[model samples]
Target chain A: MSASPGVWLAAIFTLAIYSFLYGDNPVYKFSEHLFVGLGAAHMAVMGWESMFNRAWTPLYTKGEWWWSGAIIGGIMLLTRWFRPIQWISRIPLGFMMGVAAGLSARSAIDSQFWRQIQSTVTMKLNTTNNIVYVVIVVCTLAYFLFAFNEKSGLGQGIKGVGLVGQYMMMIAFGASLGSTIMARLSLVIGRLDFLFKTWLGVLK
Target chain B: MKILRSSVPIWLGVFGGSIVLLAMFIKIPVHVGLWSKWFLEWRVILASFALTLGAGNLLRIHANRIRMKREAWMYSYVTIVALIGYTVLGILFKRTHPVYSFIFDNAYSPLSATVFSINAFYISSACYRAFRARNGHAAVLLLSGVIVMLGSVGIGYAIWPGFNTMTQWIMNYPNSAAMRGMNIGAALGIIGVSLRVIFGLERGHLGGE
Candidate 1:
């Protein structure tokens, strides 16, 4: 029912992608390649905009010499394409990695480790559900302990705890899988809704 | 050349990482904080360059394939044309152009959504093969999965009101516990690896010796 060119284009591409469900074919291949091309171009455009806004704009307009370092680092990254000057790329790579490592390590310590442990330990285990949660958490942590010798008494106890942890994790994974399937199914439904309602006018 | 090739990078990493790490804990004069902020910005700029590099690499590979007339070479032409065409359009008219927006909304958005939607079928087939209740653990996992899936939909409510309650309990308690445990383990691993990289003990990123 829709005469819009955009709607028509979308319908064709959507059907082409869905065609993969039957089997690999030229229609699917063409769509897939187009998707990759568009995706890469989008990324490059974003990168260019980011460089212009974050690095070039500051250096050019405000005369902030400090940002020149970033521009130099970015340009150095392109040297990776040239075989003779590939090693020059490592300087920027190292700088990026170092800063990332520092930031991640710091945040992981606070948010992932300390905050998580603090919250878990401080939880009031008054109810049966609360007790179960604490037990599961402790058991799951135990499962990851690889240093324990299973022959020792403490190790045997740990092994028992680890088994419970394994089961809990399996249940967790199953729940996650169910959640993922539902999310994907929702997307499929949305696509179908577009096809039926917007494109074909088959649904109210 | 040798120093530029190896030692300088290691020293730079050590200096940059140490300064950033120290700045977090030690707010030495106002300059340290400013320096750290600058470093963070530099990281973002460098990351943008990395994205561009990745795009360039993809272009190169596809261009090579087209040149060689390899299997499915015609598709490579489609890719290159689309890539170059979109990039040119974006650069010349900017992202706000009507044509650019039209292509993105109709072509890119639909393509991305359909690609992800197709995963629902694959995941269902995988679940069928893997969700067999051959043992107690498998049974537990399968039961949890079934409850969650059903409880999320209207049909499950019609089947049993208790399904929703069970789903909520599983997600809140057991799932949260497992995720917390995994997060802690992953955090420790990150700390260890990051420290190694910071100290130049992990030279793997430097590529071949």
Candidate 2:
């Protein structure tokens, strides 16, 4: 495949970064610094655009005067650098902080707690798979509880169950690790594909 | 006497939080409740400033590095230039412009992918040492990992189709169960933390006066 100038530059940068696998070097450092700068710069540009489209347009064009409060508040955030007015920045900072807490709490409670309990409670235990799932979940949760004295008979039983839970966790974690390796390998494969097809013209 | 120090910020936080939380659950007539909608829009504006704080911090660090002439500080110049150059280009020419996309595609994309991909080598190295099954628990983990790996690849299926089924069973049952337990625990923690923030008990974000 014929490659463009941009593609050639991309290939060069990719190789420069890949050199880090062997050892730390100037090329890797250069690429790393450039990447950091680019990422931050992109975020700043996006923030500007967001302010324009989302904040500025509604306030000026639509005559949403109350938005001026937010604009003022957002500016106050900059006062964090100045000592006297730093307290004022907390007004906006607190506003955003409260909003975030509300949003996250609402979602977490709904999606994670309520929904999961619903699923667990509604399961049909007639099937072996369903039974095993419930048992494993119970045992896993038991592993986290340390209140029971291990020397007691009941505590020993719980410990035994928790040990089974531990084994199950290891298997699950192993699968997760396996999946991560596959993902990482896929990235390598993608780079190798580009090198061969786009840069070297070795493979079609 | 100490209203500003003690009460005002808490009231502000409560008021701001109530505005957002109420809007989500309560629906008001558009004509009368335009004010409620304004709070959401205000949030977006306020959020942008938070974005500025992050970039500003990064710039401050690099600028300080340059001023002090720290070792390899020459790289700081490259970072500053790239950051300012890209931000200016984006504002002037827009992100869709050829030069912007070219820089993004070439400089940013390859670097990101390469960084992530480099982890593959470390993981492989770590796996070689860690996967040794000296104990029973380690044996189970290694067995699961091997089965999953072999099952995922084509060569594994070529060798034994049962590898895939074994992997499917392990993931679907044990993995799902463990993950569910973790989710429940994490969600409870999130709820506790969120409540603390909403109730003004967590003043950590407010910093200091």
**Per-residue C-alpha lDDT of model 1 across residues B1-209, encoded as one tens digit per residue:** 89888877877887778777778788768777888889988988888989988988888999999899899998998898999999888877889999889989999999998998888899999887668988888887788899999888889999999989988998999999899998998898899888987897767788844
In DockQ, how does model 1 score against the reference complex?
A: 0.76
lDDT of 2 by residue, A143-169 (tens): 766789999998999899889889888
What TM value does the first chain of each candidate achieve? 0.94, 0.88
Worst 10 residues of 2 chain B by lDDT: B28-37
**Model 1: how far is B90 from its true place, Å?**
1.2
- lDDT by residue for model 2 (B1-209), tens: 36675556666776666565555566664422454456666778887887788777888899999899997787887888888899999988889999999899888998888888888988887776657887887787788888899989999999999999988998899899988877877777787787776677877665543
Which lDDT values do the candidates have, in the order given?
0.89, 0.81
Superpose all Cα atoms of candidate 2 onto the true structure and report the RMSD in Å to 1 decimal: 3.0
For lDDT, the strongest prediction is 1
Candidate 1: list runs displaced more than 4 Å: A150-154
Docking level of model 2 = medium
Model 1 Cα lDDT, one tens digit per residue, A1-204: 999999999999999999989999999999999999999888788888888987899899999999998999999999999998888999988888888888888888889999999989888989999899999988988898888789999999999999999999989988988777888888789999999999999999
